[model samples]
Target: MQIQKINLGAEPSGIGGDSARTSNGKVNTNFDAVVAEFADVRASIPSVTSDLGQSTTIAISQKLFTDTLMSQFNDIGVQGALGFGTGITNKLPTGMSQMQGTAIKGHENWGNYQYSDGSVMVYVPRFYYRWGHVNSPNYAKYGVNALDVKSIYDFVDVVAANAAGYALHRAFYDDGQIKDGFFVDKYQCSNNAGKASSIKNGIPLSSSSANAPFSGLTGAPANTLAGAIDAAKTRGSAFFATTIFIQRALSLLSMAHAQAATSSAACAWYDATGVNNFPKGNNNNALRDVNDTAVLYEGTGYLTAGKTGSAQPFAKTTHNGQYSGVADLNGNMWEVALGLTQTAGSFYVLRTSAKASALTSGATLATDAWGTAAMTASYDSLGASYGELTGVVRNFAIGSTTNQVFSTANSGLAWSASCAGIPQLGGAGGTNAYGNDRFYDNRIEHLCPIVGGNWSYGAYAGVWAVHCYFSRTNGDHHFGVRAALYSV
Candidate 1:
């Protein structure tokens, strides 16, 4: 690893002057070079010697040496050419606007949510972006089409330290710039300001040595689940026994976190399925206590952009399930999150606890990030005609015939107060996958009101299975149902 190589293709340093009075001025330039990012266990631990109470200083210094050594050769590039130099800034990496200045790209680090109802929710990060370089301008602008088409996957294991977390990872980190940039690569920090910025580059983000690298969001992203185990085993003296205990510990924690996790707060994951030849389903606990890697794994701790709510809605709702920040709820079931709030009418109830106190809110109503509808609304109101007597769903029809029809347009179909019996399409619904299509769910909570009722939903073949939720009415009465924003 070169120590201060700049894009000039050679090491950039001062040439010793001929005159006895050499220059004594300091300049601020990126010391672009290879770096070893790791931590000193001994420095942090009290005793790690044979005496178990020996010199803390020696132990720390030793661990520090190892950390530095491993990071030097730690980066094992599996996919493309890997090198360090001032050229990093020559092509600044892009991430979520909030993750600015981070060397590592996000999304390549986490997974999304999957539910008991065969539903899944995800927030696609701005993983695909073009960098129109703006380094105070006399600078150059770069895009993916220009430099080495590298990837963060090449270093996932090194970053997370746990290949297990790589399992079930689903994400698409692409650099859309076709003409001027480089493919996604890990962000390598350049020097910092004022002090020795050189060491800044070596400060990788993850806190684990391996295995449990991810953000500490609740539920799936909890740092302690896989991470705590990694720490206990890798950092402890009894590697074997400690690992077993950690596994048991993680199970308890997962269930707890899972228990508390609401749909809106589910942790997201990266799509590790084949894009990088990663295994299909990551083993839940493969390296429970194994930290054989010679160096510390330094990468982002969390992979998600906005999964702060790890606790269950039971814990968040101010009204005790009456009202909350759920996404798949009725319009009245409102709260706020950057993503979206959904009224539960459109969402299909799919668990033993479909009602309040049973199921928590679904994944946060996420607008599409991959398709053209990312900015569309995340929820729709299941109101009036599709009324609720008590929390149960009821249907109301207005057409002369029993057959109910729906259009892509927000046609007010069943929303009549005085039994005109028309159904309506919500304007706030997320756009469907197929242009404005409708999805028919045989799993209607129940049919109500008018004599024998009929509900019909139609959309282009592409529209029915769309992302939006639909509510149906059989008769005039409203149905009673627990609602919240939902994601499938």
Candidate 2:
């Protein structure tokens, strides 16, 4: 047990060659130069753990001097834990790659947009149908399980008048397999289902022969409105099936604006009594299923013949409530858009051609003779103009001033605050009391555009309702077509 050599430096240990201080000189605590600098930091700990696990090149220059001292002490390092680093042996400084090209392309919902006149626009949001159709298999049993929808189902072959243009041309031209293989027209509404060889009564005329004589000269991607805007431009690029602007049909009626308070006053009709906006025997516009089924459809009204009343299914009609993402819109039936018109004293518009060169200088762009010299590209009713309104108002009257109407007058076509001057809106089962009012009048030529509102007008089937009094060659059962796309 021989341990004794506490010298504490500055010298005096074996006593007297230097200073170790004491004898009132008082100076200690250098425990042998802190035990020889803790034995030289425990012999440089395995060479600083093998230079931080072989990051060598002297651990990348001591990790770039410990990331510049952790970015000037605590700004955190490794560029916030590995984010930037590419090419030129990366140590990243600016390279979001391009030209110095190290491969750095990033964008998530990338649809592409640039136009400020620099022109580039591409947008393909899942091929935008805005949330209209797409569920199919004839929607299980003709869809609408919004939960249960009171059981009973047949839906009178799914509410005719072109079954919302045959379920929006079978969710994108006969069961959209990417718009049925890059589109070659597959709209089918009556070529087989209710067969007559093609009895033109559900008239949207695509003609597989049989009585085909509505003569907008026969062509049927889904039958007119220029074959549902050429099958909604095959799901992209300015496609249209009648949303002829009015602020793009009130941005699709503020996406079913809160079912205008309980589906706009309800009405599958049955003497909807007192009618203070037609609430009487309400069904909140049919089709339920929040927990199980049956939200209101006590029957007696698909015009009675076998009663298909409560309606609401297909895509499960979701105004601004519940099913939210755009569906039946307001009641089901009646959607007809394609350019918009009102004629006389000014309101005409035939658009496209980049919306008539972007309007405003007495607004031009019409031509192609602007209809009537046998207008081509589908639709002719013997041509007076079917590119969108020419004339021939005959029985439902209101024609003869030369045509092209629907106004709210901001002076020569502007209307939209739910459409001013005329083209009235707001789903009205009966009296959702102007559920959001407006439905203009003062007819002009074959009017056209008759959006949302049918199932017997329970509170006026809304989504900005408008029935410009028939005539784009009129096809009833209630009339339908919805599927739009846009680019540029």
- lDDT tens readout by residue for model 1, 392-427: 333222111111122112112221110111223222
398-436: candidate 2 lDDT, tens digit per residue: 111222222222212222211221322211122232233
Q: In candidate 2, what residue range of length 10 has the lowest lDDT sum?
A: 145-154
- Residue-level lDDT for 23 in candidate 2: 18
Shift of residue 183 alpha carbon in model 2, Å: 18
Please give the TM-score that candidate 1 achieves against the real structure: 0.18
**Best by the lDDT measure:** 2
Off by over 4 Å in 1: 1-107, 110-384, 387-437, 441-488
